[model samples]
Target: MKTAALKTVDRRDGKLAMAHFYVAFIALALGGLAGLLQTLVRSGKFELPAGIGYYQILTVHGVVLGLVLTTFFIMGFQLAAVSKTSGTLTNRQRLIGWIGFWLMTAGTLMAAAMILLNKASVLYTFYAPLQAHALFYIGLTLVIVGSWLDGAAIIMAYARWRKANPGKPSPLLTFMSLVNTILWIVATIGVASTVLIQLLPWSLGLVDRVDVLVSRTLFWYFGHPLVYFWLLPAYMAWYVVIPKVIGGKIFSDSLARMSFILFLLFSIPVGFHHQLTEPGIDPAWKFLQVILTFLVIIPSLMTAFSLFATFESYGRSKGATGLFGWVKVLPWEDARFTVPFIGMLSFIPAGAGGIINASHQLNQVVHNTIWITGHFHLTLATAVILTFFGITYWLVPHLTGRTLTKALNKLAIIQAVFWAVGMTFMSGAMHAAGLLGAPRRSSYSEYGGAAQAAEWIPYQVAQAIGGSILFLGIILMLYIFINLAFFAPKGEEEFPVGETSEKAEKTPMVFENWKLWLGITVLLILFAYTIPFIDMIENAPIGSKGYKLW
Candidate 1:
């Protein structure tokens, strides 16, 4: 239980957190609408009105949902977690965080306007040789820099806490928040270098061409770890918050901390796994990175085990009989628990798909196909998105002093069900169609009704139907949040923080050694990336001029 002194809340920090979440939801709404349009257009039954193109819709969908929404939400959620768990943020910290938030929001708007005007149809990846407006790159670069400032605010807060309470292990939630913030700051270095030094200059006409291979190499350097950037927050909820909602304690705090540390060590160097299919990277290096990719899975497996153990222990305490009977005893009625629980379940298949993607031989079969798309939806769309939904049910009310209405509570459950059903139809079909050699990232009518192409139409229709249902689910979520934010009855809810069932014998000092882990992570990244990067730069081909393909 938190002591009275420890439970103090900061109004300024809370306001900052709320501001971040509000912007994130706006992106979510806009992105979901664009996604529905993309699904319809790809289904071949819907056509864009004059002046709008399919690729523009797609670029907006990916950029808003994938980049903007996730970045803002994670920053807000982590700031809140850190402040609540460690202590209230100081006035300076709050001011710094707010500045970051505004810079990020401004950057988002600038890039979004460019996208809307069809000035930058480059997809979220914004791979080189397919340039966007310089403003688009500049705006995104600002978002990254802004996020770094927010991370600095968080780290500074943690540093002060450590100074005041020397030798005390950080609270697990605060520790995990710090881990993710640090991971993000470190991982973005590659992409920041790419944008600031390469893409921005090329886009602004300071340079006529860019080395495609080198640019791509820099992107995936940041890109694959970007997956973990979206995931670790969800894992934070799974490991630290869900157990308390289910009337249980965390299974093991030490294991959880170790997992976070391992993620720091392993996540960044493994990005080359995403480039296994590309040329210019040596096969030996790609194979080595694939092994590192497999290493990253260890932390996730640890997370899965820890979560299940928490669930199983909770079940047995409730008098569940037999070994597996505990599974049936979980708190399925609570949206806070069930939504994240379902997210955990979804990760099983998502993790499997990731392993398949990492396998060099299997990757050749599925690379750039709709299977990858299905896999994407399974991991981020279901696992990350659903957990965020669960966080919303508990978090909004916690921050706003508003009660989640009984009607909205029931609606939350329905929302999860709708999302699952929609993703099932949509991603399942995409996976099947992918195996049959259906293309991805294209409008299907481009195939001109070939025999093989005709086979994918029904699955495309399934995806459209599924996407429509998912959009409805998001709409319902927005309604619940809006009601809670502005109109629900005013009442404070306790922040849920679970303790470990067994007290540790001693504080695990090794787990708290951030510098040690960070240094090792950097070394691993250098080992994995140094040679390939040099090879690409040294053997540069005639660089390609930027294209406006869309």
Candidate 2:
């Protein structure tokens, strides 16, 4: 192939990855505005001027930050991982990727516009009985469809790479990309069907009294998996980027594959956990999802073990010994370690809230409180957002063929670490406040003169301090993109990450064979989700659902 054609493919993939970065950061900025406003409202500091509508801002913040930003970033990361593992991309395939990017981008913009104009006020969940404009449903469907197309492109590229290079176990990067794409294909179909067959028609008034249960079940069938979809890229970095940066091979490529496959199978029938707070869902169905929900810890724990083991090997190779000594030996200065560290730490509270929210009894105390927001913010901020920045800094020197400024890069890592630290203290406070019955969305600090409610004020104030640290950290991270565009050396320099490209090309299965783990993964997932689906739909009465998807 001509150098021009190769450069074309390279440039397209690189730009799309960065496109996701830009879009995600912008979304977070909006969410931060809403989040800060929410804090202020609770703190009794400031309120939106008249017509600035809290519900609308909340909805915008939620959808933009939660859905669009996360989705685009994953799509972007998939392209990067696939390109590295597959060796090269075909030109036609490259174009499809960009087209997918544009469609999702347009759909996201249209949906965000609806939120800003106050035409869509149904909140992010937009649970029915409350409806958003028809355009909201249509726009979201477009986003889903666009993502499906991106998944298809990835699937095709993986196949082509496989055909051209036979009998070799697929590279870990390509393998993970396939699993994510397949998961997305199965996952998004539910919401797409719900939107096309039920929600959209009802919104257009073509149907009267649409079965609320049907749409709600389908919407969440996709919804729960979407969270995993948002999360998979970070997990990818954990498996691939972390070990490479530590100068260690992954402990078990097979384990990583097993975890990804488990995610696909378990994530589907697990939607019922999300509905535990709402009324009208079949009680047995809820329990089934909950049971499966807890099972997720199995795969997650495996991931933790695998990453730690990888860290252990690196520590041993570097001549460190014992359980905790390895911790100090690992290079925290590396962006990969820094991002993964922040990501893993953030999951501590997120996992706790996830467990409480999943449990039938505990959820009642803090459902929909500021604690829930704190949990997800910790999850997103620590996991995907920081990792996205980390991965970008890791890749940019190679992509632009420019030597990145070491000082600014280190600053980015500092800011990211600080963001994670801030969320830790802040999210902990949110938990305490929630237990005290602090409300989630409110502009007035008065809390209707409920004294206990009023006592939670300090935690809310504490979150602003956390938020300020987080916001400044974001500024340092964002400065890199600006710095890159305006300044930076023209040629790539030798760097410590000299090993990543080699490893991406060939990641050895350090301990276990991926094929064996792959089989175990399939069995576990099948066991986890199989009965849940039957109990959810087959056992429940027709039209038995209580809530509707907006």
Candidate 3:
């Protein structure tokens, strides 16, 4: 590809991307407020008001931040990346994207209203037996369908590009974006199937009861991979965006493609790892999923190695002298580099904790404890959310044709630091308290006056402090983003597109074969899930009538 062509810019694409982002940030702000309230309540420093319950707040926090925010943001970012790297989307594609966006936004509003009204406080997972309003289920279904349409738009654009340039490797950003979208579409099947086939009817009174185990089984099938749906966009930054921000190229384009393919294949089938403690499924299947879970880790390790290699190569060329010297030579002053870099460092502990969670023996220790809570805060909150902040440092301005002021740039650095420090304190306390027998998803201040529970109080207080700081950080991020979008001076800034160190002029073509990888991904999902799903159905217990416990 010519350098000039690679620098393509399209305002139409930016508008569509920003539309998704606008909704995403709204979700972030509201959900983050709920997070603050959660910590306060847990710390025994605050109590819920008459109309607002703890679980209601928890449901909004999880759904808005975890599901709604991540989905919209990823779609926006992926669309933006594809347009810049590949080519502009046609008018029809833009129309489809807008339609999808409206559907998603409507769905979000419906779901939010239901949760706030205390009609759908079933929590984000919405596990069966905890019944919610039918509108809640229908709204969620619309969100899923909207996202599918959005993904389809991106895929269509890519397909057009491939048709125009037969045999050429798809641009790295486009390829990564496409793979992530496909992974999402495929991973969502588990949840969509359950929601459409079971939950909607059950909630609507078409079915008097629903099988608890079967519903849970279906949920876990989508639940674990849901984590990756959030992580991959962040990984795209670590792989593609960070390299460019630091003035280096990707170490190898082929390696990055391989990692994405591996994720597509391994991420879905490993959902059973989350159900290691559940009894309906046999231990044998759990073990198989555990092995598959470990397999998914390989791609992440590959990414770490590739990124280090890029840093080293750039560092040596700039006169750095030692194996570790590259660390100092990278662009530490750039918010675009440093913010996401902190996020990358966070994943080390988070990923290690995930291994423990997947372990059949070790999971018995921390399965329902706050330790799992700590683990995810590091992963999704720090590793994923921090990266999203970094992307916004440039992405918002890039879309709005605005200049990111030097003053605001420094503030961005402080924002990232606040998040890191706050998460460390909160997640640290969570881990310590959980190991001491603190349960998760509870509003327990007094453990029946047990002395052991007293130990957790101090940690809970620390969590409140950390939560406050993190809340402040998110508020700062929102202010900066809004300012960049509407108030900054107009300026020209190129979208950063990292070049392949050895460009794909003559790379192996096998890496670009989407059909081959997609086939294998489906096969692996079947291999891992078929027997267990069949068994669950054949010996399924009678469905239980739903309960409104809250």
Candidate 4:
């Protein structure tokens, strides 16, 4: 708000963005490998060696992709988005932020390496008594601590900007940074506590059997919140970037703020729905969580409503009118449509399955099946991968000062569609097969019994093909990132600013209020989290159950 000399903050973001590009691909590649191996194992095509090798691979894949890769990539996006949106800074505080990025990378690498080595068998959930090497716990903790430092840096820079120019309302993009950091701190508390206190000693063999529910409870506290952590940035990208790309305005500034606040509130508390398959949790509590889960969906639905509204407005301006006719007029080549298209497509399936599993009754049909896996990957993969695709492309020109080759950028977009469709078909089939009694977390699927595995043949082939598409997408993403990250020319010439560029004053704001948004955020989180908390803490029943690997 104070300066017109808007330039790209090519801090750790450009490097981290590129560095994280590698990390994202690695995580996806390994996870894909594991998924393929798992399919082979499930189909009786492959077998595991003696010992816990399958679990080790599964665990590493989970921790690497689920925790480390997503966190790093999301942080990179946040840094870039804030810098672009807030019209602030001159690299005074950015230097400090990049220092934090290296710390995060070191911690994540250390943890991932240990997991690959079979030192941590608890999954990223890091349950106790599943002793990992101490280094794993230390590495994990450092990653989280590093994030906190990064958060402080962003906040400090924003604070400085505010102090310099009073009464200037924070842009929605900057507002996202504020809420996201708050949610991050709130969510990570559970995992941070476990890593430092419960897990550190347990991994050292100081304890025999840790309370699995306690472990699960804390994990879910983080888990549900983690979902928001992933979704918010994507949603923000969708809100702030997508419409502008399509030549439209946000449906309502108030509606967008409402969605954010609701997400923070409900996302953290309703994690227990994940625990529905476990026996120790009581039915009453699970049901209550089911109710809270429903409540959470309402806000998400509002988000969907607002998103469609934004699109419709954009569509009409392009001279389209019909129930869904506006969809056709969109600039498909633009990062806005391409990114949101992938994201929206993924959410539909995920949300449908989510509603089913949110209930105690419906979860029974899908419980512990590949259906569960398919559903989550559909949700998370779309939300994180597609949006990251857009952010990278959007930032590349700014950071490198080189406009990406049109051909290469076009290839990236096509690759995204391939990944999205491939993941969808593959994951969708997994859900159907799961309903027919396929189990999860196994390296091999054939039990050597006489039962025919013919029905799964088509599904497996589809999944493999889909995996191939995703693999190609990742490869292309890496290639593009590498080119931009290192070799892309840094042009000295000035180019016209793109829409959604706040510093350029291209998009005008409709509302400006700090307390109003902050208060709404608090209220949403409270409503979302507390209702389910009551059901879980006080009402849920208990049972003793355990499963052992063969």
Q: What is the lDDT, from 0 to 100, of the residue 75 in candidate 3? A: 97
For all predictions, the C-alpha RMSD in Å is 2.6, 4.6, 2.6, 5.1
- Candidate 2 vs candidate 3: the TM-score winner is 3
Better of 1 and 2 by lDDT: 1
lDDT of 2 by residue, 277-349 (tens): 7665667767877888888777888888877877877787788877787888888886656866777767766
Position 110, candidate 4: lDDT: 85
lDDT of 2 at 377: 72
Candidate 3 — which residues are off by over 4 angstroms? 1-3, 6-8, 446-448, 503-506, 543-550
Cα lDDT of model 4 overall?
Answer: 0.68
Instruction: Write model 1 residue lDDT over 1-550, tens digit each, in one string.
Output: 2323555346677789889999999999999999999889878899999879888998999999999999999998999888888888888998899999999999999999999999899987988778888899889988998999899999988888788777878888888989999889888988888898888888888777777777887788888888999999999999988988988989888889989888888888887778877888899999998998899889998998888888888898899988799978787788888887788888899999999999989999998898998999999999999999899887878888877777878889999999999999999988998999888788787888889888999999999999999999989989888987888888876678887887444548787787788888889988998998778777776545534211
Residue 350 error, candidate 3, Å:
0.7
Question: How would you encode candidate 3's per-residue C-alpha lDDT over 402-446 as one tens digit per residue?
Answer: 978888889999999999999999999998888988988776554
Regions more than 4 Å wrong, model 1: 1-4, 503-505, 542-550
Candidate 4 residues 1-550, lDDT tens each? 5434555654455554445456665666676566555544554445666654767777776787787767777776676666665654446556666666677778878887787777776665666546788888888888888888777767875676667666755657766776787788878887887667667766775643455566677778788778778888888877777776666776766667667776765676676788887765666666666777787787788888877877887787778888998989887876536866777778977889888877778888888777877887788877666876777765665666676667766877887877777787778778887787666554334444435356665666666666656767767777777776667666531211223322223322323344665566566556545654455445433423331100
TM-score of each: 0.97, 0.87, 0.97, 0.85
Score each candidate by Cα lDDT: 0.87, 0.70, 0.87, 0.68
Model 2: pairs clashing at backbone N, Cα or C within 3 Å: none
In TM-score terms, candidate 2 sits at 0.87
In model 4, pairs of residues that clash are 41-444, 41-445, 42-444, 42-445, 265-524, 265-525, 266-528, 282-540, 282-541
